[model samples]
Target: MNNFARSEKKRQHAAVDARQVLRALREMKQSERPSRVRMELPLPQAGVENDKIVYLGKHGQLADWSGGMRQRFRATRPLVDTLLEGRQANFAGLLEDAEDGVGVWACDGDITVLTHVADTTAGLLFKLLRGEYGSAPTREGAMVCVVNAFWTDGGEKVGNPWEFKLREEARDVLKAGSWEVVYCLRAVRTAAGVPGTIWRRYPEPWLVLDETGRVVLSKEGSEEPSSAEVAEALNRTANATE
Candidate 1:
């Protein structure tokens, strides 16, 4: 068989094996299959920042590393309790509080993100405010983004690049942390015609990728997953089976 044909056959076999293994596990009742937690809270309304600590993306929950602009959405509870709940949640790194709140920089394989101590709308909190991430061209195939917000004495928004003025302690922590990160700041125009800078985070859909791109996970317009759901989708047509 051709290389493409061989790879396609292998992927199909892998998918079939995955389904069988999961079925066996469920049948044996050894452990429950992993699933997404659906505990998102009401999102924060816009125009609500009155010296507010921050913002969030996606149903008011903590930001996922991908989905591009969805990072600006916020959630009402801790993302770790849901998204990264159980073994997927990594807690091995420290991120200095933003002179405001407390949290840790978590690493999930090649992925690195932050999770806060508490999930309150007010008081000391590590607000997931909006910013830019992967706006620049780089050797890495995928782009990512996060924006750190600061305001001026007159309450005007003073732009702060993620690369500039990082706490020394935080910098040291990142140096030896999960992934090796070395990035330079780049300026881009904001929607309001002002210039700003952003820091990139790990790419997402969690752990599904290959030589082509993303492996399929779900059907179109489906609200919930089905029994056939697999992290990597089968990405080819079947043969005649002669």
Candidate 2:
């Protein structure tokens, strides 16, 4: 009664333990596996030409203009006279003779230009510009917007050196060991009849590191520095260097 009963009891206990172990293993595998997502966002249409000129007025409304209409504005004698007197327009040669047949204009912080043939697609440009601007000095954050210019080879071309005034200043903070500029790049537009059809805009704060390697200007702050702030930082550095 003792030996046989003990052997049978042990066998039943072993069978139950084996089932529990198998169940636990299956649960663990299920927990570790990534759930499959059934729904996905549709991709935007590609290879479409956006030739409309959109001007963001001082009041923040967008005004659309045709290429011919824009050219008419350029033909105005008084405006041309004023531009020549002020040396505002970089019209050293005929507009048709311009490289890549593009023009660029900046009003306050808003920029308007012709689109390029290569970088005009929206999604690719957005990703490239996001990488350049979404980085913080020592942290990570998303950008509000990034405008970019594209080279013919699908590479983002840096805008005019003057346009980089803010980025250059942000670099100064890193140079002074106060911050670090982790990312910088250009946005490209390939839409037709746009001046510079390609331009670069900074949509994110420049990443930096303080002397102690601390993050100061993070994206989550109540106050993030603007391009002007970066320019100011650069100016301070320039004065110090001088």
Candidate 3:
């Protein structure tokens, strides 16, 4: 082959090798990363706007209430689907069993109830309408009564402790069925810019449970916990109530 043709062939071969290496790295990363559970709820037709919904706090104004409800339905459509199908679906339950059950539901900016109980079967089933889970009738309506799981690394510099702490406090609020409380976890970005890594550290396994005692999610720190630490935090939180 001509020199120019030979050079072009070599360039093409290099490009192919690079692409193959990148694909392999991506697959490895995906396999090593923790699993995440997400549910998308449907929104009401009358109140949705610009894809953003409001979450009306318990004492929020009527206008705010309407917007939040719309957003929540839009976000949790997946969980609603499972509920309607009469499947034994519980996000928190699954997490708890997996030992990575630190769950959170975004509430789609609408009203959401975080229940103290880990079991969410009954609540999920009750929300179904004609094999579908619909939005709450009012903007002030409450979505499912459970927290979804979220995972974070504590060893990072900017990690916020509030993520897991809020789950602990949520148990108390869940018992009251009062939506007056809101927990906020803040973390400042470090020089390295790791998200949610600068806050306090928790080495325990976090859990998310439905009201029906199902563990939908669970996560442990990269460092395994001692028997005592596991028993203290996990067991205690499992039994906590609002």
Error of 2 at 50 (Å): 27
Ranking by TM-score: 1, 3, 2
Per-residue accuracy of model 1 over 131-220 as CA lDDT, tens digit each: 122122122221111112111112112223342323322233222221211111111222223222211111112122222323333233
Off by over 4 Å in 2: 1-61, 68-80, 86-92, 97-242
Per-residue CA lDDT of candidate 3, range 96-143, in tens? 322222222323333233222223222222232112333431333223
Per-model TM-score versus the true fold = 0.22, 0.18, 0.19
For candidate 3, the per-residue lDDT at 233 reads 42
**Which scores greater on TM-score, model 1 or model 2?**
1
Evaluated with lDDT, which candidate comes out highest? 3
In terms of lDDT, the poorest run of 10 residues in model 2 is 36-45
Q: Which ten residues in a row have the lowest lDDT in candidate 3?
A: 180-189
Report the error of model 1 at residue 49, Å.
Answer: 22
Candidate 2 versus the native: TM-score? 0.18
RMSD of each: 18.3, 28.2, 20.6
